[model samples]
Target: MSNLVRSELLKIRTTSTWWWLAIGAFLSIAMAFPLNAWLFNTAVEGNAEDVGLTGDAASAPAQAANLYTSGQYLGLMFVMLIGILMVTNEFFHQTATTTFLATPRRTAVIVSKLIAASLLGFVFWLVTTVIDLGAGAIFLTLNDHGTLLGEWEVQRALLLNLMAYAIWTVLGVGIGTLITNQLGAVITASVLYLIGTQVVSVLFFMLSSWLDSLAVLKWQVLWPAVASQVMITPGENEMLPAWWVGVLVLIGYALVSGIIGVLLTRRRDIS
Candidate 1:
């Protein structure tokens, strides 16, 4: 298993895909942090009612969480693409046949890909987190909102952010497994992640309004993107489920994707 994982990592390191995705993730974080910090500062000063923050929402922990998790929206998408590329690249390069022939046990190969993809995801999280911490600390101090590292809410947000990175990558692997066509998988995943979430949210909002019940809004957490956002939220939200619910939702998606991917790969005709 170790050797298989190492081989998978080597494959990733040898390619340009990983670095391109990493660069995208880094840029997303860099561009997002300052904008988020500015908006947060604006809200903190009581001038931005449209920012949707009030009382507890404007607390140090909440601001810190938001700052620390900045760029998650696009970062996760890039990470997921990396996962999709991991499997798709195999098929794209005509290496699937060789890979399976060498390994024989397809499950081990898939698991190794999952492990490697996950490590790559962690690297993304680590890089983004370091930037967040440094920028967040300075921003917080400038705004008189202590670094708040001692706060559990801040800590939980960071931890959950890391989990989000890992799980999304695994989910990507599952996506790649299902869609072997590299271009199709990448386009589908990118569109669904970047646009589908907004479309789904709008539909849900319309449904809730028609039904005259805000309860319908809670179901938004079922979507992976929303679930990711929900899990890292620093405090209670009336419109969303508990933070753990989001974690569970994402985990369920990853598990289902993995199981289906494994089952399909076992019988797939690589040739």
Candidate 2:
């Protein structure tokens, strides 16, 4: 298992795609700095009418938390693409044959890929978090907005954002595995994570409007992103499940996708 995991890491490290993905994710984080700085400055100058600065939005902690979380979220798509490519690229280049030949037990190979993808996700999360936080703090300081690095609320938000990124990456891996075609997998993940959630939310809204009794379904977990929003943003949505329940829902999505992918791969003929 250890050897298999090492081989997967080596495969990733040897590829130009990994570096590009990492660099892209970092660049996304870097780009968020200016946007956040502008937003912070605008709010500071009492131009919070356009932005979502409602009651207490002028508070330092609130501003800091928003800056950090928003910046980290910006990089989420890139990391997920990395995860999708990690698996789909194998099939794209016809390397899965060699990989499976080296490890006859397809389950072991799948597990190794999961482990490698998880590690890659964590590394991506770390890079994005550090860059976003450092840049955000600098911008805030320069604008005289003050820093909330020491605030417990800001600290907790930072941790949750990192965890959310990591979880999303793993989910991407499962999605990539299930959809072996590179383009297909990427499209599916994008639609499911990005568009699918909004569609579901809208549908639920319509259903509840037509039938108030159906409102109960609104609280039921449907999408991983929705569950994650519930977990990270407390008290904002009364219809969302509890934080722990949201965590479980996310885990369920990742695990079920992995299991299905493994089963399909075990029966698939590489040649």
Candidate 3:
């Protein structure tokens, strides 16, 4: 059991993809520093509404969470790539056959990959989260708008956002394992989670505006549902489901995908 986890971790360490993804995640999160500075500076100058935040919405804590979480969502794309690579690499390089021969139990291999992906994803999240919040705090303090480092809501949001990144990695593993075609899996997962959801949300919004009967579909979009769970902020509309509901919806995807991936790995003849 321990050996499986170790092997998976070793697999990750031996690869260059992990480091490159890590660097990308860091840079992606770091972009928030300057953007946050601008937002806070403008809000402090009484232009909060210009930034789409008003009243207490322009508070330091609120802005800080927004900045930090904005990076988190952006960094998710890289983390998703990381997760996709973790499993697909084995197949791409024709290493899965040897890996299964050594372990014999395909379930163990899948479980190991899942566990390792989670840990790796968590590390990515931790690094980006630290950099994001740290940079935001420094910039906010320097700008005299104060910092939200000690705010409970911001802290909670940070934690949830980190969990969301990790969850995406797990989801990536499931998708990668199920699809197997490296490029296809990556593109499919990206489109489904990233672009597909946004398209659905936008279309739903448009339809709802034109015909109120379609308003119920607004809460059913995949990405926004998950976003509501992971984000500490409210959705752009009031129709999205509750946070817990989103969590369950995401978990449903993870569980179903993981199961199907495992079943396919067990049944498919890996030549």
lDDT of 3 by residue, 1-271 (tens): 7899899999889879888877777776667667876886777688898878765557767667777665665577777778788789989999998999998899888888888878887888787777776777777777776776788767867877766777777788888887889999888877776677668767877777777765466466356334544345533344644455666666677678788878888887889
Ranking by lDDT: 1, 2, 3
Better of 2 and 3 by lDDT: 2
The residue-level lDDT of candidate 1 at 56 comes to: 61
Candidate 1, residues 1-271, lDDT tens digits: the string is 9999999999999989888888898899889999889877777777566777766667757777888888888999999999999999999999998889889999999999999988988999999999899988888887787788888888998999999999999999999999999999999999999899999999999999999988899999999999998899756666767899999999999999999999999999877
For every model in order, what is the number of clashing pairs? Answer: 0, 0, 0
lDDT of 1: 0.90
> Which structure among the candidates has the greatest TM-score?
1
Model 3: CA > 4 A from native: 43-46, 54-59, 213-221, 224-230, 234-237
- In model 1, how many backbone clashes occur? 0
Q: Best lDDT goes to which candidate?
A: 1
